[model samples]
Target: MSPTTDADLSDFVFVRRNDGLPIEEIPFELVERKGVGHPDTMCDAIAERASRYYSQYCLEHFGRIAHHWFDKVMLFGGESDLDYGHGELVNPYTVLFAGKGAHRCGDTPIPLADILRRAAADVLSEVTTGFDADRHLVIDCRIVDHQGAGRGRSRYRPESHDDLVAIGDPSLVSNDCNLLHAFAPFSRLEQAVLRIERLINGPDFKARHRDTGWDVKVFGSRNGEDFSFIVNMPFLASDISSFDHYLSRKAECREEVVGLLRDTLGGDPAVLFNPTDRNGRPYLTALGSVADTGDVGAVGRGNRVTGLITPMRAMSIEAPAGKNPLDHTGKLYGVLAQQLARRLNEMTGKPVETHLFTSKEAPLDRPDQVVVRVHGLQDGGDEEQKIRAVVAEALANTAELTREIIVTGVTMW
Candidate 1:
């Protein structure tokens, strides 16, 4: 990809609606501070960690046997402020996972469910802490069987499978007192269906319309010739002044913001935009990429998945009398989170999931703000280094734009 300096800013400018409501940028600390122990954060961390571990297991153990093998996985979290009477619920958050992979033999093929489950279990074991084993840590694994005949000696055959394996289980041991018991005997196919349902019917789906007052939008697509990808961008005000302020301080906070973006949006560089009509507003853009295969069998062989996850500290749009003034600050952030997820999916040719979280409290210092954090897990031995390396690089690149915005006081709406 060309550097930002190389590209003409004119083509990249993104305009908002005619209304004066320009999008705004939110601090990463507000969204990512949920801490590692939070249920939602733990779920996301475990699911991705497990999926990656499983993928490596396949590559190491089955690479010699299968002609091709790979996996696509995603993690999501959600919460309702209405559940708690006053402040937002802090500890009991929901986490979800969707994963799929394929393996081919010379003529015969094997389902990868067994390997996926073991990997998931391994990840859960490594990450679970503080919470009771029975009530904390839930695992869901999905496997799609895409087995068929080879078109020709060199022709690619992208087969679509109808069979699925879905499994949901709790990482902790069972406790009688905990009513929120985990499911058992998880199936990979069932998990796949659940993931699809979330992609199409989850909260993010309801959050996509302009009238819905939602903060984000997500979209996705996949094909055999090319790899699957997801994109997550934000839609906000186009005023450049906000961008300027953000750029001015980018150096101080860029590392955390960019790191979060790369981890969430894949390796793609986050893009900042200035629409033609608005000289003062700016928005952020992110793209994810995947490989494309060539051959007759590869035609129409792909799965596109998109998910939107939004977490709000409060739902009331109107500020209460005699109360601290509400900021109404993070709505644009919710929207941007959705957009980034969609963009990443499109670019990578892989299934995509996006999440958004907001706080109702005007000043974020109040206990009302929702906190979120992310972590990764790897297989035993040498695999740990590889996972850390990928995550480290993503954090480094992600820091650039975030820091730039803070220091230069530049806004890319």
Candidate 2:
């Protein structure tokens, strides 16, 4: 066969190796996920939404999305005075939005600060729901460079909108070498934990249980056949009147949660609820997230781009938040690796670990290196071909992922 071109991706190589043991033989595994209410997850979410919304606004008004990635976002938690059944924010959260973008589309200047404020407010309202935007949140925007930066820096095309006809794709390949990895078939424990969290934060859950807050977290560990799950959730004091009521609610939540998990997964996983505090005082929060009382948040420090934090997996520590969804391989590779891992596992019907690396300016269609490690496939023959096909299919969705991320802005919960 001939060499593969950039668009064709025919030259891509896939290296596979045995995982030394069968998937079912593995003894222990652990997985963790930071909920949307986590400080770090909040930072990722706010920055991502801000960039995506601004890009959309520009695209609609100027015919092209102006370049901007507000990755460097900081949230300073403020004070909240609270008691059993009542609470109020003594000071609101202070958020700083710092990044570069085109402030002007021709002579008409874009509403820069307005965009920032709206973005921050909208994101907090959507992600951290029930949090008071006007009274309890203070958001500010500081553009790193008001002057236009290069396209690769922020993925802003150099050709002006006025510059009539143009050549090929306006976007360029990744400007830096990015390495990312993910594992196949999320453990049953991981899925169970995520489902419980989404349930707690969902509208139906809230409607039924008004006292339950949205800021919730899930951590799971497995020891042979035994499993342990730790859930951290706070209750709103205003919803419940007395200390007895608080304890009663807590007991009810614990029982129901344990029963739900047992029924859903058919396992005797020990469920621990809010073990951090036993001082007779219930954990109360004015909002769903922990940003209420001096919790800090930073980009890339929260969940992986796939929304689950698998400490055991060979995943990247780099934060994929606030990058241009269209061209930043940092974020794209994270999603790509995850999809490839799932497909490879389905192909071989075994636990799979997939890794992909791309050099600076390399075509996004092809990776500089691709590695697939399977945990004991029954048959080694034809595995390589099947793995390669799976990778090719995953890479093929690069454009689609880019478009979805840039346009819709996928959130990590």
Candidate 3:
């Protein structure tokens, strides 16, 4: 839906239906949430952190995040049995981290396998409730190198590779021509639900709501003034006793969430947790998440580039999470596209879609395509000139995009 923020529409294209209803005035809508426990998002977050931990390790020792590409990660969800408040995993996760990387710093082994496995354990613990990282799950971190315990091959044998050749490499550029966008003051409902999830998942929140697992997902929708949210969060069986007790705990969590949403959105919004489950059976996690059950997840299936799979708007399906933080356009341009969109919208007060495309090995700033689409923007108008100037300035400021991505961690989906 389009934004309702008041703006001068004199030079804008006022798009309206025959009924004269704005885009946000849809009578009905559908929104889905991919929980943090969901297989795909779990994989995405783990993979992202894998790169991040490695990047930090590299920067600390080698002065930069050396050549590591881990886009081939896979999450294998295991099976579990649950009745009421008790559940147990019969088969735990068979998570495999496979990909290419430079796993050495001048003969000093970087401990790639250890780092990736630690990354998995850290992420799994953070994303779930009562799951034991060392006992409840099986993790296999394999690097593509001729080393201790990796899978394939590293970049020309990590032992004797030219370190300086890999570092500050010009070929360390975007690998794909991508189109990314950002919401300038993002959608209100989006911000509200995300904030609510983080609030409920915080250590302070968990100290109170023990039944509320860390794997939280919030799906927000609006029908004009009526807003509602469907959250899919796994309830920890260790904290819950019976199905009735589980429901009661779930209700308490929902009530707390509803209060948060109501205050933020300034209206009463319906909040439901695990709405599709029956009374006798619900999403009760033996390990504090649905991943211990029959749910299978992949890398790119969870969130869009914006971190939420919002289908109603123009978005990139590129799984920016866990991709190479330095060179991959899927990660670098995800930030770039968002920056471009935000700046354009801030200057013009118009719904803008900023698209910048760059091929492999090309300069990140010198995009082959720099196209900005503004709603109601006329071609060759003075307003268009201002918009172009704004885009140019933003693009000029992106010389350090890669540095920012690796330093701050790639934050898109």
Question: Against the true structure, whose TM-score is highest?
Answer: 2
**Candidate 3 residue lDDT tens string, 283-316:** 6777776677766677888776556666666667
lDDT of 1 by residue, 56-134 (tens): 4433544321212222232232221221112122222122233223443334354445544444444333322122223
The lDDT for every candidate, in the order shown, is 0.25, 0.71, 0.66
TM-score of 1: 0.25
Give me the displacement of residue 124 in model 1, in angstroms.
Answer: 2.5
Off by over 4 Å in 2: 1-12, 21-24, 146-159, 162-171, 376-383
Each prediction's TM-score against the native? Answer: 0.25, 0.88, 0.81
Query: Alpha-carbon error at 5 in model 2, in Å?
Result: 6.5
Return the top candidate by lDDT. Answer: 2
RMSD of 3: 6.8
Against the true structure, candidate 2 has what lDDT?
A: 0.71
Error of 2 at 242 (Å): 2.7
Ranking by lDDT: 2, 3, 1
Count of backbone collisions within predicted model 3 = 5
Candidate 2 differs from the real structure by a C-alpha RMSD in angstroms, to one decimal, of 3.5
